[model samples]
Target: MRYSPNHKLETKEKLLESSSVSAKKSGFATVGVDGLMKAIGLSGGAFYSHFSSKDELFAAIVERELCQSLARLGGHGEQDCARLERCLKHYLSMAHVEQPESGCALPALGAEIARSDILVRQQAEIWICRLQESWARILDSDSLAWAILSQCIGALVVARMLATADIQRTVLQSSQEEIGRQIAGRQQAICK
Candidate 1:
């Protein structure tokens, strides 16, 4: 039997939601059609009704995952610097880096995206744009926000790659303090 439009849309949304977390935790390439469908009480054959192919699904889910991270990190704010600080602190904390499944996609799936297909790359750019815009919102300058995002992402990626918790914490704390100072200095200069 054919499903209604609403049903089809709902299925697609569920598929994206389930697959987003799975892809984030297990890398997009590894999340099989069978497993993904099974997670949402559907079968492999039904996937095509929602997505044309695995790459399409990956693209959709990646966009969603990045958007979620951006939102979590306070993507938009008028002047609540404290909220932005809290989000950054949480982002770079040892807990965030230690858990790939529950952390930002930048550190968790950066390498995968770098090596992924064009569709995924395009989605990655959208994510990058979101982050850049989010940072600009906090710093009030497009360049400064992009710079801070780059530094934070780079530091988190390197820190997560380290073999020991101590090194990871060191990287986290050090980057956090340095970035914090930079942001404060920028804001102070503006105030002065």
Candidate 2:
């Protein structure tokens, strides 16, 4: 039976959402088209209706996930340093470290993203640069913005790799402390 156009759109949406979460939680390269389709209650053959290939879906996922990261971490163009400070605190928190599927795609999928085709990598670059630009405006220093952005993503990856919560917390706290020191040294009271 033929479904409504809306049904098709909705199914595609569900597939993207579910598949992205699955990819983030368990590297995208690990799952097949059939598995991704199954997560959305569709047959593997139906995958062609939404995307030409898994690579196409991956590009879409990269765009969707990074767009979300930009929105969450990039804040409005208000130049409020505190906005980034607050975001950093939560970003380096245990909750984010514990939830790969629901957190930023960078740490969980960065390796996979790096290995993806040029187009997917470019899509990630666009959003990442946008996020950096947002922070650069707030911090008034491109160097600091890049450093903090890299540090935050790295800290999360480190925290998640440890086998114990104490060590994970330490990794996060150290990064948070270092980030605080960096911001303070460059622009004292900027985030206060």
Q: What are the per-residue Cα lDDT tens digits for candidate 2 across 1-192?
A: 987969988998999999989988998989999999888777999999899999999999999999999999998877477667889999999999988999999999999899999999999999999999999998889989999999999999988899999999999999989998887776774545
Residue lDDT tens for model 1, 57-96 = 8778778778888778755566466777778888888777
TM-scores for candidates 1 onward, in order: 0.86, 0.95
Judge candidate 2 against the unseen true structure and give its global Cα lDDT, from 0 to 1: 0.91
TM-score of 2: 0.95
Top-lDDT candidate index: 2
Question: lDDT score, residue 130, model 2?
Answer: 98
Each model's lDDT: 0.81, 0.91
